[model samples]
Target chain A: MAFSAFASAPAAAEPAVRRRSWVALVLLLPGILYLLLFFITPLVSLVFTSFQQPVIGGDIGQYSAGFKWENYTESVTQYLPLILRAFGYAVLATVLALVISYPLAYFIGVKVRSFPLVQSLLLTLVIAPFFISFLLRTLAWKQIMSDEGPIVVALKALSVFPNDGHITGTPFAVVFGLTYNFIPFMTLPLYATLERLDVRYIEAGNDLYASPFTTFRKITVPLSLPGIVSGTLLTFIPAAGDYINASGDFLGSAQTSMVGNAIESNFLVTQNYPVAAALSIVLMAVILVIVGLYVRRAGTEDLV
Target chain B: MAAGTFAEKGADLELVGITKTFPGFTAIQSLDLFIPAGSFFALLGPSGCGKTTTLRLVAGLEEPTAGRIVIGGQDVTATKSFQRPVNTVFQSYALFPHMTVLENVAFGLRRRSIASPLEKAHEALRLVELDHLAARRPGQLSGGQQQRVALARAVVNRPALLLLDEPLGALDLKLRRQMQLELKDIQSEVGLTFLHVTHDQEEAMTMADTIAVMNKGEIEQMGAPEELYELPRTAFVANFLGQSNLFTGEVSGSTPDALTVAIAGQRLIIPTARAPRRKGTVTVGVRPEKLLLLTSAPAPSSGSNALGPGRVIDVSFSGVSTQYTVAIPGAGDVVVFAQNMVFGPVVHVGAEVWVSWNVEHGFGLEDSVEEAAAGVQDAAAAQSADADTRTGVTSSVRA
Candidate 1:
């Protein structure tokens, strides 16, 4: 609760400029009241639950409120592999999405700028896939890569797939699903930035005796850094916390379960609320630290 | 060695039979031009008159559909833009937003095997007097400073030819005047061939040694500023460069040196030696400053001023001159600008005056009156239409 409040405090400074105004306070009452009820109250209770102790000689789900910080340590020790695997899959998917989206965005933004008809048509095609349900799309991908699907059958006939090898319930399928689903998230921000790029800079580069490749490297790449940063962040954050694609009933099996699956099973099936809440808090903290380091190391602070 | 050859014979930039066609329009048509080495030349015209197209052709930014380009006695028509021995200062400045001022100036040098790139970049910045701001990005500088940086970047390469495409168009009026003088000074100090393209008549006249006035993808007239202004051969040239009072006339009599034209039943004499193509039907043009207004009748023996009575229809007093539009009995409205000396004779709107000018002051032109009027109307319509389309003016975005 304190962390979230610190993150959003800067954005609330405008209305607070009039420090003595009851009208400003009144205007913010509804939103503040809503956050207190739905967000802050539940968040405080979750933190309380994270410190609860399991009751001795009681039912399996019974517990008592106490100082049990050991719950956080035990959860981290047991689920450390799943936590690291989740981040690895997220990093791979985010990188793949960025590599695939940058060229597609550039082609739609700069190459077809003169032809408004073709440009809008291609942009619409990029976004049209979102009209279908996300679960349906992932399910369709599952069918396409299943053991009985044409891709697996064709590989088996060509002797590329061994008799015992399979693509279903593998890490490859999970990462592929994550990348395919989050491509639009990566593309939209990139398109918005590249669409406004000035072509005159490129011509100026050529006029200065720089070759076409050098011009793209020095001018185009640096100008588009903001798009690349935003797109990667957008794809990576949600992919790190996603559970459906890595669940046992979906693309992954028991061996490939991620941190999200572990938290889900602990919370719903086992009814161990303290351990689940501890894992959730740890996941949020770890993501925040990784993102902060990535942003600092990217060294695009001046460009943005 | 290449610089030695260029210095010996000048830049010697040449364009032979150049033509450029878009989807349905031909921007340039068989244009032929030769820019002498180490000369400050300008291509001056109104909007869409192919002046910019000609500059881009020379810069190798656009390949001409038909002609060949030769620079320093070498054929460069087939070469790419980066391979040409030339550089351009873009109208937008187009400074690399991510690079500092020093890096922007050193961009061209770093691409090739140049020695002491950092020293050379600082020297170029010193020429533009912006060396102290070398560590700052282009966005941190003012518009005038950015313009100077662009100039420094282009000149640092020291190519055979330097092309400036409206390099001062984005500055304020006062800054533009200052940069115009600075650009001219830079060109002379460097002694490289400078080809400037602009639509501003005053800028072109003040900076260029030779000016080519282009119209509709063709050169209408090319000469020194005084020559083009004094002895314009066509109605378009006379009206475009400066204001001219033109009257349609017919050649009633002729001499070996002059011709007497009958204009509105009044006889006017124009020198035949000075006129280029004088058909029987000709248009007589006179500069507004050349016509002298005399409220009183001239002496009977005076032969220098050919006199006619007219009524003043309009009067405007500027700081240095008083311009009057007089409606004459035979000729249409004749505009006369008199120097504001001693503030004598405050002419009212309805005052009667005698409009007189020397016979040599009038020149015959080739365009008919109908053609001139239609051309002016078309130009006015085009200007307003252009303004409507460019209504959304935006400030430059910088990081």
Candidate 2:
């Protein structure tokens, strides 16, 4: 029954091809409708809200329709330091994620390749954090960094921390949560690239008088650049705009409040629609610019 | 040159009592080989026959279970691949996909920090006629072009020994033949010792100065290509190197002229020098091209061996020659190849025919010692043995 529609009249071959395109267009209707209703509508509404002006003498949350572009300039000026701080935390988190993930990905992809079941078990462990709510995981980190927790107490015991100092509500805790939550995103892409790396290329390099370290530098590093580029984008884009880790309800204190926290407060606490909309738009634009510059610099066209 | 230094020219390679064993089985058993400087050598065998393992041992990719490898009088068995002065043209051409062809060729030079690596790399590229494509990546090139890039990459080093592991296995037949001549030319022009490993017999014969026929983790025979083909010492060589028709018979007697072998109530004389075994049961073989077909028996001649009155079972026409399979009742089907100087096959199927050959062309092998050399002959032997069993004479029964 499924193939019968495809097996239309042969004498009308041209018409059948035309009809086939119509059938393909019909199959696309639901996705197109969903994108238009959910995505395009919200995006246009957000852009409209970013340009809205506050009513000179109205109640809270009231605004007038106008091209009051000052909303962008004013909000960006007020939150410029927090915006830069968000970017700094995101960059640090992405670098930490990469440093931790590469070895784990390489271990799964190249080292345990002959033991596929063990490799798959390790891969499942990397992904197993997703099975629980990240919010709950963030709370768990909160507990782990509490005063009586082993990590804080051990650091105090080791003299790495001043005995009188504390651990919770620090920038380290917020960045740690971000890195922990986004590590699997960094790892899976790197694994996909490394698993398909032909060992023969490495052997050829070795045979051509390349020391193993030189071969890793010349061949392995360049080949995995595509993975690093994509993994960085995946981690950075989310980490920069992530409110969960930087919210006062989570890891952040007043000192570590990132742009995401400020935007959240502007919308819910202050009931300021234009500033919230403006902040979200600015976050997306800056991420796009950073990603564009990164992809161009990395010089790999095979991005996924 | 001493232990790690290389001579300016190709170096003689010596493998003394090389043995390699895996966990499950022995790959190569107690093998010794010597290749003179600058000779193109081939290790020819079927898959699982340890030819590739032998190549890996020499390349220092796989350590031998027990052996010593000496290249240019320097013991390289203990050295890593990068420390040894050896380069390889790998099977899939193993070119770096991320680098331009020029950069791929320059990789080894850069590793050693050689002066003017790119200049030298371009010169090597020009040698393989790939200089025009040097700026492009290997992925953009065709299989043939990538093959040339690999050749250039290996040849640029000018190592004392160059290892090629089935380098032409990926090309089509015409391109493989073209590359065979090109590879031979490069070897001679560079004057470097080449040790090529392959499963293709014709490829080995076409390119190598010396061919080592390996079977079952052992060297069956090693000699010049034509010498191995013409005077193969083992039945495995006779069957594996090319087509051979084998017959088992008792050594009846000898004349000053030749030794006589009696088969099915007929006596066939082979030269004394041609027969390896002078007494008891022996297996004699003649190449297919040396045999001719006749519709009727001629008056018996003293200088010939003829097995006859067989019926033609099949005939196939190749462009250069016509091949016929003649089935003798108590003897196996004998293959005959005749040149196409005339039209079609000289005889048709189901015709009575006599298969004849010059007596000097036949060679005898020891049947008792070569019981393991019965693989390719088993199919034809089983058929004839069945027929002999029906008649209760059993002329060729070794099992």
Candidate 3:
């Protein structure tokens, strides 16, 4: 009787289970289509483009392209320094942003939990600059660091440099602007991770005889490392590709011109389609390598 | 180096008039207690009875509003929890998720101003029989193993006192029973002054040498488990500690050893061994198991002070016993638990029965109903006065 009852119950419930599976498929179809159309297709095209060379006066006018290993070789050898420099700047900016934002995030997330008003005020201060146009914010930095600006006058008064002192159009200024622009990106994610952290872990550490500093280092830091890695990636990737911030604030000085400037010059001002495409593909490859290494080191779980 | 050495080193802990008041509620009210050198003492109560607050006060996780706490004869009332010579196993275990079992156990020893970490941690793990699973993280271990890791972590410090707050409340019934025995055995082996707080009466009775029954931020009674169960001083203590059938009556006469009370128009004599200030209306408390069920009323048994004819209202067959609810004339229902001797015949509902107990089996309580009623009124007035004082202090502090 029990066997018959079980068999009948499953038979009766099969249609409901099938209906639920159908509903799941219907809900998932949109996201699946979006990934295929936008992400997968673009990634395949970029890889294919990286290995191809543009042919002038081809039969198809613009469609015919042949595989060329020389493009990859020339780009690596000739433009490797610029690529490395861009990565260097991205790393420096990410590190600086992380160093400055960690304590701020920790303070806002953990220390100021009892003071909602203060916490909200701090969060607003961190997020307020984003509300303004990014170009205008970067332009404002250019004005502030000009030779006639207050910063130069202050520097002159301090006898820290020549009386005609100015930090405008310098690599230092570019890095400073990138760090300032991306600090909130680093801080907000870190704040979220730290805020959701179970305080019991820290209390457990204390109970187990860990000093406050030791507990923070061993427990809080390692536990929040996922946020750190994600925040770094979020900040660094954009900062490396930030042409507007770098060129607008630093005035496209040669030393400060990153891969972002190279891409802008090739695509817009220079209007060299093939070279621009090549540079875009190369830049994408470099970013992919950096991100892949980072993801591998930090574990993909950190991204989610 | 040895168990109970901390007690020999000094008295483990003392709390003098500890009080904690929150925004509009008083959690603990002027509690004075002392945990001896190496006893498994339990602060047992229902929810909202301030047992956890008492534990927190001893752990230095809470600052008593008006009291002093001393551990190992050293004043630690103002000290931070980290600075105190004590460790706590929180209710959830609170095992550090990022740490392995060995690291969790080693944490306290590593923080010690004295003692080598490896040696102390090893000793602690060995004590809890968790040395083999030391490499695994708390998440990797079973619930029972995680609990032992927490125990090892706390004991590694050899703190003056160990505070366990409902450490086994999260475990399943079988695991909880096993842990009860394990904890009692561990306490005996370590001989640490354990101050455990729990709401489970059975858990406290089974594990504690001394049990303090707390109610509404005050301890109703504190004594050895057997004494507290066998001779509870008040209805609250008797009911809170275990199930008891209480009969309310006015004391008509008293002797050195017993008292005669009129309960539901029936005259009954009750022993007064643990009675407190017994001159007025009294409540006679008798455990369910103490009442014997007879097929026929025995010829007025000697030393038996109470006899009542009752009808068995309900019979429930527990695994080891049959519990019968009996109703006496003019009196409310009383539960009578009888051990199942053999399957002779079941006591069916509506069966006529005689329920009686020896005078020595029951004790009388000075009526606390009036006092409990008055206590509510006093608490309200006190709350209002406290609010006023707090407002005054707030304005003053603000100014």
Highest TM-score: give the candidate number.
Answer: 2
lDDT at position B195, candidate 3:
92
Compared with the true structure, model 3 gives a TM-score of 0.82
Model 2: residues with Cα > 4 Å off, grouped in runs: A1-20, A158-160, A302-304, B1-7, B254-258, B295-302, B366-373, B377-399
For residue B236, give model 3's deviation from the true position in Å.
1.6
By lDDT, the best candidate is 2
Interface RMSD of each: 8.6, 9.6, 12.5
- Using TM-score as the measure, name the better of candidate 1 and candidate 2: 2
* lDDT (tens digit, per residue) of candidate 2 on B52-140: 99988998889999989999998999999888888999989999988999999998888777778899999999998999999998989
Clashing pairs in 3: none
Q: What does candidate 2's lDDT look like per residue over A1-304, in tens digits?
A: 4454557667547765565576778999999999999999999999999999889989999998889899999999999988998999999999999999999998999989999999999999999999999999998888888788888899989989887776667898889989999999999999998998888888899998888899888888788888888888899999999888887778878888899998899889998999999999998899889989988989888322
Deviation from native of the Cα of residue A264 in model 1, angstroms = 2.3
Expressed as tens digits, the lDDT of each residue in A41-143 for candidate 1 is 9988888988999999989889899989998999999999999999999999999999999999999888888999998998898898899998888888888
> How high is the DockQ of candidate 1?
0.37
The better-scoring model by lDDT among 2 and 3 is 2
| True-vs-predicted CA distance for residue B148, candidate 1, Å | 1.9
Ranking by TM-score: 2, 1, 3
lDDT score, residue B20, model 3?
Answer: 98
